[model samples]
Target: MERVTGVGGVFFKSKEPAALAAWYRDHLGLELEPGSEAVSVFRWSEPGTTTWSAFPEDTQYLGRAESRAMFNYRVKNLDRMLAQLRADAVFVDDRVEISKFGRFGWAIDPEGNRFELWEPADGL
Candidate 1:
């Protein structure tokens, strides 16, 4: 049998796409994709895997009920990332979850999309 290797990319609709991309670029250090301000390429040099998952219909983990998906970004430091987001006055979830897999934090983008940040545990 064959299996999917990893998530290809995250595509979503934004009302102010260019502004949103710029926000991500300025705040999260994301780079704009070539010839496109509304698209970004989040390239990572480290070795890791992207997870594909689905939540129950009634689950609230993805924020707005109308939202069908959320983007999860892997980072080097959860604390520092969250702190910068907070200092930028972004809407960050008060809760941070720690598990054997890694540490997790969440924040709402300017477009009101809740996104996740993860700092993998050692060897993950």
Candidate 2:
């Protein structure tokens, strides 16, 4: 059996498609194709955390309502990325927390989906 390699792209619906595409392009440097079948592709790495967790079915989160929250990209320079997002006036929830695992922060897209930005603990 041929095993699946990795995620190719992430497709989602955006209310303000153009604006959102521009936001992703300007901030995250993701080249978003503006349309209903828009996808933002990026070169991702292995997750820092070994054990991946999932939210309950009855969750009240924005992303939860829209099918499933697909990807959580890991970053080595999270602070710098966060700074860039801040400069763009993007809506970032300032509830950053450092746990035994790694550092975590949240950023909501124009469509109100909460995406996680993680910086994993060293020597994992």
Candidate 3:
């Protein structure tokens, strides 16, 4: 089983999400969907490529983050991947969530950066 396939998303905190998004739009030319408050999805050109967005500074969606950014990695199997991490003595969180989007799990790196593991919903 492939543990991690590719990066699903790159998330970070922003004091002013709209202003930062506008900067990306004007400077980087990232076409952002209008009227999105906290998140703006950037879809990949390749099929099955996952989306990326930024969250508000106070958002708890990424759990406790010592850093301003987090990385979401696309996984083949969240359970197996987490199990492997635990077997290697990695600090894997016990909480796992399943939603319409997909299954999610979290792990802390040696340097204490939090990262997400995602098994995307079917056909996503």
Query: Candidate 3: how many backbone clashes?
Result: 0
Cα lDDT of model 1 by residue, 1-124, tens digit? 2222244335455556677778877998777767776666444455664543434455577789877678877777788888888888999999999998688888999999888888877765
The residue pairs that clash in candidate 1, if any, are none
Pairs of residues at least 3 apart in sequence or in different chains that clash in candidate 3 = none
lDDT per residue (tens digit) for residues 19-120 in model 2: 666676688776643452235544346532332223344445425565465445566756776777888888877778799757767687777677766676
Q: lDDT-based ranking, best first? A: 3, 1, 2
Q: What's the lDDT for all of these models?
A: 0.71, 0.56, 0.81
For all predicted structures, in order, the TM-scores are 0.62, 0.52, 0.86
Model 3, 74-119: lDDT tens per residue? Answer: 9988999999999999999899999987999999898888899999
lDDT of 2: 0.56
Residue clash pairs of candidate 2: none
Task: Count backbone clashes in candidate 2.
Answer: 0
TM-score of 2: 0.52
RMSD of 1: 13.2
